[model samples]
Target: MSAWEQFITYVSQNGFYIWTEFYRHFLMAAYGVLFASIISIPIGILIARYGKLSGFVMTLGSIIQTIPVLGFMAITMVVMGLGTTTVVVTVFFYSLLPIIQNTYVGIIGVDRTIKEAAYASGMTQFQLLLKVELPLAVSVIMAGIRTALVVGIGVVAIGTFVGAGGLGAIIVRGTNATDGTAIILAGAVPTALMAIVADLIMGKIERMLNPVSN
Candidate 1:
């Protein structure tokens, strides 16, 4: 049989297994980004308030990004050991740069005149952030999340290396089998589709949040 026929056969036989792996893969990516967002968003807001700190924080995030994926995963694994926990931690580290950078840019990009107007209207700094700046900046912040999530989805595939199951696990299994091209496709096709679906959904949400959207 051709590879396509084999792929369909494998998928039909293991539909439940594939679905479980797909769900696991998505949860790893989502959790990693979710945890990062809780911290990075606050850090971004702080650095935006302190212009001098922006340079240092951004530099730190960039430095993290520069680390090779396998190398970074090894480092995290040493501390956390194998399985999904390590992968989630690795994903968190990998996801920081885009979210932090975007949040900083979005906050600072708010118009100076609008900020001034808020002050004139007797708004406290915190009130201004809540009522003025954040509302305007949310779209750009969402853009950061959009970027982080897409990248995170890709990164989670590497989680298989640490014994964290995902679609990657299926691909790895196929690599050891004779005539495993179909098995590899069974894993790979879902991963690509998952990423594409995620990107499309996030893109729509980002555009909706954009203040200038008609």
Candidate 2:
């Protein structure tokens, strides 16, 4: 049978298991991105405000990003041990740089004239940020989030190496089998589809949030 045919046959016989793995994979990515956003956005805002700290922060993030995913996971496994916790943490680390850098850029990239106008109108610093800067920067920030999320989805597959349980498990199973191309596709194709769907959804949101440019 062809790979596609084999995939269909496998799914028909193992639909429940496949679905469960898909859900787990999604959960890992979602949780990782969620926490990364929570942590990174605030730090981004702080660095943007300070100005002097941007280089240091960006350098740190760059260093973290340079580490191979497997190497990072190996280090994390030592500290956190094997499980979903380590997987989620690893994903969170991987997702942080893009979000932080984007948030910083977006906030700082707001037009100086607009900021002056807001200040002249007697808006407080906090109000200025919430009302003016963030609104204007929402599109850029969303783009960063979209990037991180798509990357996170792919990274979650690596969790299988540590027994965290995801579609990667299926891919690994296929790799170990004699005729496993079909099985690997069963995991990979869905992952790619998920990333595409996420990107489209985030794109819509970014467009909606973006201010109408002149």
Candidate 3:
């Protein structure tokens, strides 16, 4: 059989297992990015509110981004032990830079005219941010989230190394087997599809939220 045929056979034979890993992988990535967003968005807003902190915050995010994924996982695994949690933590840190950067850019990108008008209309600082700035900036913030999620999906694949039960484990299994090209592809194809689907869905949402699009 051709490589493609073999890949199809492998996928068909292990559909349930593949799907289980896919679900696990998706959860690990999603949870990581979700947690990161909860924290990073607020941090992004604070730094935007106080410009003095932007540079420092950006620099800190950059430093975290520089950490080797495997090394980070190893460190976390030692502390947390082998599990999905370790992978989620790694994905969370990896997700921080894009979300925070986009959020900061989005908030500051709100128009000066609008801000003044909001202030003139008796909107308090909090109200202005809530009512005007955030609405306008939402698309950009979503763009950051989209980027983080796409990256997080890839990061979660490495979780298999820590026994996190992601598609990466499937790929690894193939690698450990003889004549495992199809097996490797069984995992690779789904990972690619997940990233592509996530990007398309989130990209659509980001565009739809843009006031420019509306």
- RMSD in Å for model 3: 0.6
Candidate 2, number of clashes: 0
lDDT per residue as tens, model 3, 15-123: 9999999999999999999999999999999999999999999999999888889999999999999999999999999999999999999999998999999999999
Predicted candidate 1 versus true structure: per-residue lDDT over 76-158, tens digit per residue: 99999999988888889888888898888889999999999999999999999999888888888888888888888888888
Model 3 ranges off by over 4 Å: none
State the lDDT of candidate 2 residue by residue for 1-214, as single tens digits. Answer: 8888998999888889988999999999999999999999998999999999999999998898899998899899999999889889998998889999999999999999999999999999999999999999888888889999999998999999988989999999999999998889888888888889999999899888889742
Clashing pairs in 2: none
**TM-score for candidate 2:** 0.97
Model 2: how large is the Cα RMSD against the reference? 1.3
- Measured by TM-score, the strongest candidate is 3
Models ranked on lDDT: 3, 2, 1
How displaced is residue 76 in candidate 1, in Å?
A: 0.7
Deviation in Å, model 1, residue 70 alpha carbon = 1.5
